[model samples]
Target chain A: MNIHIIGGGAVGLFFAAQWCEKHAVTLWTRTEQQAEMISRGGIRVLENHMENIYPVNSKKIESLYVEGDLVVVAVKQYHMKEVLPLLQNAAAQSVLFLQNGMSHLDFLEQVPHPHLYAASVEHGLAKIDGRTIQVNGRNKTNIGSLRSGTAGIIDQLQTGSFRFDWNENSYHMLIEKMAANAIINPLTALLKVKNGEIAENARFRAIAKDLSREFASVFSYKTAEDTFQSVLSICTKTADNESSMLKDMKAGNLTEIDAIVGVLLKTAEKNHRSVPAFQLLYNMIKGKENTPEFMSK
Target chain B: MNIHIIGGGAVGLFFAAQWCEKHAVTLWTRTEQQAEMISRGGIRVLENHMENIYPVNSKKIESLYVEGDLVVVAVKQYHMKEVLPLLQNAAAQSVLFLQNGMSHLDFLEQVPHPHLYAASVEHGLAKIDGRTIQVNGRNKTNIGSLRSGTAGIIDQLQTGSFRFDWNENSYHMLIEKMAANAIINPLTALLKVKNGEIAENARFRAIAKDLSREFASVFSYKTAEDTFQSVLSICTKTADNESSMLKDMKAGNLTEIDAIVGVLLKTAEKNHRSVPAFQLLYNMIKGKENTPEFMSK
Candidate 1:
């Protein structure tokens, strides 16, 4: 099987480095410069204090061809829309979206793709530099089929370090993952604290409750307290780890604010639920994201 | 004339350095170690590409004696209560407060001192190291007499660099100054941006308006829109500078959240007014203030 990984980010690099052992992998990046670097030197994984290189064919997304490939969209939610047209322009045997947040879900439902899937990539991977990825935490790719009558892509994607799980219902899986993501991602990014801080810090926990309660109103939760408890547990479990949103903000990458907070805020407005904490943080992250680190004298 | 400056922070050092030249100035620090360091080395002023030392007597707050001295309480709002008893122990000729926020206003209302005053010190100052200070923005100390018919302390506080203004109505002056501080201080500190970013950044400005409106409810504003415009103008004027709260957070000092936001929240709660934005920032600053930067592994 041939896997075409869209995006040369930390996610795409990790997948390409892992799945290349089982199947042929081609990496697609936004720029030809990154593709050329990866094509010439290959992806480097700095793991267990050792440098290991994985060979894969890398190309620019501007020249993407997905006819005979299983295209796994690994780009951020902010950039997912830009790449969606390219997938529609070509025909892939299977298209799997590994983006965060529910922003892309609406766009996916309208598409006539017969074999469509969405995934939650639960991993701590950092792209150190050009074609170099540093793997930290263990990874599990949760796959859910978006389209009916489609055999999932779980069988095609497995490696020694990479794990895969097939969910019976994709929407619920995304919601569950999002419950944690929506709570943890923006808070860590805004506060510039580790994941555990949200649960450990009393004030953060207070605000977290506000966020969870607001989030619960938009989605279905038995109680906001139960939702908050779940979010706190996730925070405690990943206490030492800096969230992906924090990492993205630190690296000056555009965050999935629109998909995660923006979409939920839209729902909240539609429902007439007053979610001040969520709205406050959304505005904060948007400000920080839009504003440069250094300003003029 | 003798001047007693409480709290050996940037503001204290600035006043002490200026006043010591004209008056018999005694600097009071929280610890004996800092007092001893200043007593031995003198206060170093790094200015205009030259390092100059200003000599003055320094003592620990524990050994405070304000018999005939004009006492200037230049402590942060968090530590104001701790030093209040010391002031009560010794009857100073005049007691002038140089603190931020309206938190100290209530404490001053019942005090029967004939020469009680509240001040708003507008300056950008940074203490480089132990017993060393770096001045940035020009200084203006707005003095208002809290005790009715008491002569103001502005006449005794003239210096070449340091400026003072007597506010006829102290309450209104503090409120007006607070309109800017409450918005700029926490926002700049929380966002980790310079003062100007609040105005320059659209998202920050939106949240600033939210904060301004909520704050206006606690106090009285002609309109929240007017309050926000004033706050934005302050941000634009000091766009290149960092707020004292941001500097304090960076330096791991206790912030004026309690005095600024905490007191406002209390008033808001009393009036049955909803100030979620103010409450959110208060909680955030409190969390960041209480939580350690480096967590135990």
Candidate 2:
């Protein structure tokens, strides 16, 4: 099966390096410079203390023909709108989306596709340069069908190191991941600490619990205790990894606050639930986004 | 009038420098080394683009006899407990407590004195060293009696630059300042920004307004809008200054989180009101306090 990944970020390169070994995969990047760099040097992926270069096909988004068996949307949630039109026009049999937060659910519902799948990427991937990405940690990708069964492309994409688990309900899985992200990402960014600090630090743990309780109250999927434990477990699992939001803040780049915390806050407002902690976290991240350094960029 | 200032922090040194010009003042500090340095070199105060050396007597806490017309406790709120016994056994006619937050109000009630007053220091003061302090900004100190009238020492302590105003209700004044500190200090420290950012940034302003509303609901002394405006004005007045809590975090010292946010959160809990924002802020500050670097210190 042929696969087309829409994004040149860490996640995009991560999946391309894995799937290129088994299936024909093409990576689409926004800038021609990034596309040229990846096409010339190949995708250098650092995994398990070993460096491997994969000869993956790379193309600029403007000059790409997205005809493939599966089209994977791997960009940050903020850039999803810009790539929506292209994804809609793609001649792909199945569409797989790998974005954080539940805000994209509404947009994904509007896209017309015969087969649609949503995924939660549990791995920690960092972009070292234009074409080089370091795999800090590896975890299973939970993918489930949104509209129809994802049987056609799921098996073809799963590899030994890049594991993929089939989730029965994609919405529930995505919501669970969103709950974890909503609690972990902003707090880590605001506190300027690693993921494990949230669990290790008693004060941060209390906050994580309170935020989880607020989230569980809004979603009604799991109990507050369950949500809190899940978040704590994730923090423990990725203790050494710096959260994506923290990385973005350190790099002076825009974060996924809108997609992650913004969506949860909007839902809480709609449900008449007060989430003061989440609101404050959201505002703080937004404040950082509007800082002079970030504004100039 | 003889004035004995307890605590050689920025506030202690600031008041000692001003009062020493008119009254016989002695400053007491925990460390004998610091006391010796201050006794030998005097207290160097930098204010209004000029440096002034005030001849002030200094003594270690152990050798100090708290006999004076007025005893001003200007230590951090956390250290107030350790000095409470000294203040209670003091031979002073009047006692003035210049610590931050309402947590000290209960402790102040236990100390017996002819004139018991609580003053909110509005100036921005930073301790440059053991014997030197820079006055970042000048503002009036609002002094009010917690018990009887403060007649003997109020006028003697008021200076041209360090002005003092008598407030009818010292409890109200302290609560007002506590509300502002509860909102400003933790937010600035967690966001890693200056005081002005709280008022200047739109998102931070919203969070500030929300937190102010929460505080107003618990206190009921002022309306939400009034509390928000008061905090906004303070942020504007001290725009370039880093909050004391922020300074403590940077210096890897313990913050007065218990005195400021802790008092508010306890009040909220007792009244059965949820203060998620304040709780989150409290936890984040505590998290920083628990860091290995701060723990070692």
Candidate 3:
């Protein structure tokens, strides 16, 4: 099987390294420098106190599209617009998206791809520079079918080190994952605490309970308590990790707050529910994104 | 007229220094050390390029209550419980309460004093030590009669450097002031920003407007928009000052969270309205107060 992975970020590099073992994988990067570096040195992955590099073909995004059996679009939701055209033009048999938040679900309706799928990655991976990567805890990458007749593709892609779990209801899966993201991300960012504090810190936990209950009332099919419990579980599992949003804030980078909280705010509005916590967190994160120093002493 | 100013904080010391120049002022301190310090060196007040120290009578809390004509109670709402018995047994003709929140309004009924008044200080003040104080922007102290026969007391206190503005509707004036405190204090403390940033920062301003509007709808006599406008005006006026709550958080001291937001939360509950932003800010501040390092990275 031949696969094309888009974007040179952590998720992109992780999938490229994992799938290249059994599949003919070509990593597509935004810059020729990254493509050349990866092509020359291979994708270096550090795990279990071991350093290993996987050799894979690579090309810049602007280069001629290499027709592959599968194309994995692993980019931030905001970058979806730029890469959507590339995915549309690619002659891949199936296109799978691995982006956080449900924002991309809306734009997927416009895509002409025959086999479409979306996934929430549980395994936290970090891409160091163009080629180096570190994979934490071998958590399952939950994948769900957005378009029919794509169950076969899900089966074919299951044979890899990157664990893939199939969910019949993709929307619910994304919502649950998003509830975790929306609750944990902005809070850890704004409060500047590690992920565990969301659950361990009594005061933060109280607010998290309110936010989770409010969020589930408007968005979740699961009961508010269930959703809140799941959020606490995630915090405990990733206790030591600084949330991506917090890191983004420290580096003064634009966060995926729009994709996470912005989508929640819009859904709450459509549902005619007043979610003040969601609204406040959304506005606070957006403000922090524009000026990191604004919220600081 | 003889005046007794209870409490030795910045506000108490400022009032003692200002009023002692005109009226015979006696300051009461919780600690005998503070009383001895003030009694020996006088209350030093820094204002308008002038360092003025006024000699005044001072005593510890357990000392016999002086038979002054007017007693200005300048303690925090939390300490009101401890000092209520003191105020009740005092020989003063009128007892005036100058606290930040509306919490004391409930217990003011228990005070057996002949006349009662409550005030909200507009002037920003800081106690340098047991005796030294800094007074910023000599804004008028708005006083209102909490009980009958207090109009005369407001008039009598008007002779001092601490300008007193008498309002017929004192509850309304306190609510307006509490609204400002509710909107400004927790935000500055949580976000670690100056008072001005609440109005100047676009993201913070958006949250502030929403919070203000939500708060006014449940508590204020003024419309939500009108209340929010007043909050903005306040942010502009005291842009440089560090809110007392923020200072308390920095100093790792217990804040008046229960007095300010706790009272508001109870009001919201009684009104059967949900205030998520208020609840969240309250919990976060309480969490911060308990562990100042909890919210920080």
Candidate 4:
């Protein structure tokens, strides 16, 4: 498969490095500096358990050709608007959004693709440096059709060392992931705590539960007690790994709070459900997201 | 008039040191250390424009007889419950609450006294060290009756050093202060920004405005525009001064968010009004408030 990755962050690099071993993989980075670094040093995969440097083709977003078997969009949620324009020109057979939040659907609508896959990365991969990924926690990745279902993309993706399943009920999975992000991401970011710290604190646990119940109601998904427990488990597993939102906070970068929490809040408003805790957290994180110091560029 | 000051932080000392020049005064501190420091060095009055220190007898709360005409409670909101017992034992005719937030009303029903005055201070004063106050702003003080019925207490407090107004509609004043604190205190604490920084940022301004609107809906306080602007102005005036909440955050002391944001949220829920911004802010701050580093032994 001629695979193209549309973001050079940890997730994009993780897939590109793994897939390039068997396929022709092209990685898209936002900046020329990042592309240059990857061109010279290749992609470095720093697993939590082991250290290995893998070489992969890296190119700027503008340099990529429009034809590819698969396209992976792994950029931050806020960048989707700009990225969508690029994807509109891409002649990819399948496009998968392996990013945080729900607003990606809006961007996906703008692109000309029949097969759209929306998935969440359960694996914990963080960008340590340019094109360097630190894989922590035994992470599972799930992908499924958003609209006009794609079948072979999962098999094509599985050709690499990536583990993914064809999720028939991916909407529920996406909603659950959004709920977890709504409760966990902004909480950890604002509190300046790790995911495990949130798990450790009963008050935070209660907050997560409150937020989860609200999400379950608005999205019409079963936000079971086990879902919340799973969230805490993720926090425990990724104890030292700063959540994406927390990493954004530390870097003073824009967070995916709007897509994650804002989407949940908007959904709640539409459903006539009150999500006080989620709304509050979304606004707080949004404040950080909107700050110039936190902006991507 | 004899005035007894309790919880000898900046407000208590500000009142005791100034009022003692004209009236017989006793400043009651919680700790023996503060009592000893004040008893030996006296209470210092550091105005934004002027500077002076006055010696007043500082006693522990247990030793306070409260035989004065007016008693001022200047401790933290969390300390209110602990100090309520002491107030019940006091013999004061009038009790004045000079702390931030609306939690003083918690003591409203417990008051055996005839005159109860609630007040808020904008004078940016912080005890940088023992017996030292850095007054960054020459802000006015507001005093009013919780009920429309108490005028005598307001009359007595009018004799204090700063500007004082007898507000028959003090509920709005309390709400205004609460709203302002909800926005300013947490933003300053979380962003590690000074007051002026909040005003400069569009994001913080949005947060302030959103929170104010939510607070107004719940509390029914009306202003021409967002009342949080007034808070930002106050921060600008006290630009170099650390906000009380920021100071608490720095010292790892408990914040009065429960008294400020939490109480407002509860009131909103009771009134069937939604306060999404405040709820998230309350949860975020509440989580921080729960940290062991925040609570004093």
Question: Per-residue alpha-carbon lDDT of model 1 for A170-244, expressed as tens digits?
Answer: 887787778788889988887778898899888989888877777888886447888899888777766677888
DockQ of each: 0.41, 0.54, 0.48, 0.29
Best by TM-score: 2
Q: CAPRI verdict on model 4?
A: acceptable
Report, for every candidate in turn, its global Cα lDDT versus the true structure: 0.80, 0.87, 0.84, 0.75
Q: How many clashes in each structure?
A: 2, 0, 0, 3
For model 4, the chain A TM-score is 0.92
Model 2, residue A280: displacement in angstroms?
Answer: 0.6
Candidate 4 lDDT, A233-297, residue by residue in tens: 77888887778888887786778888888887788888898776565566556666645453221
TM-score of each: 0.84, 0.96, 0.91, 0.84
- Candidate with top lDDT is 2
Model 2, runs deviating above 4 Å: A290-297, B151-153, B290-297
Could you arrange the candidates by lDDT from highest to lowest? 2, 3, 1, 4
Number of the top candidate by DockQ? 2
| Candidate 1: C-alpha lDDT | 0.80
For B1-297, candidate 3 gives per-residue lDDT tens digits of 888888998889888877776798889999999999999999998887889888978888974456878888898888988888888778888888889989999897788778888889999887778999887667788988888855556566766565788889998988988999999999888777788988998889999899888798688578888878988998899898889898888777889888888999999999998788999889878766756564344
Q: How much is A83 displaced in model 2, in angstroms?
A: 1.0
Residues B125-153 of candidate 1 have per-residue lDDT tens digits of 78887699887667587888877534335
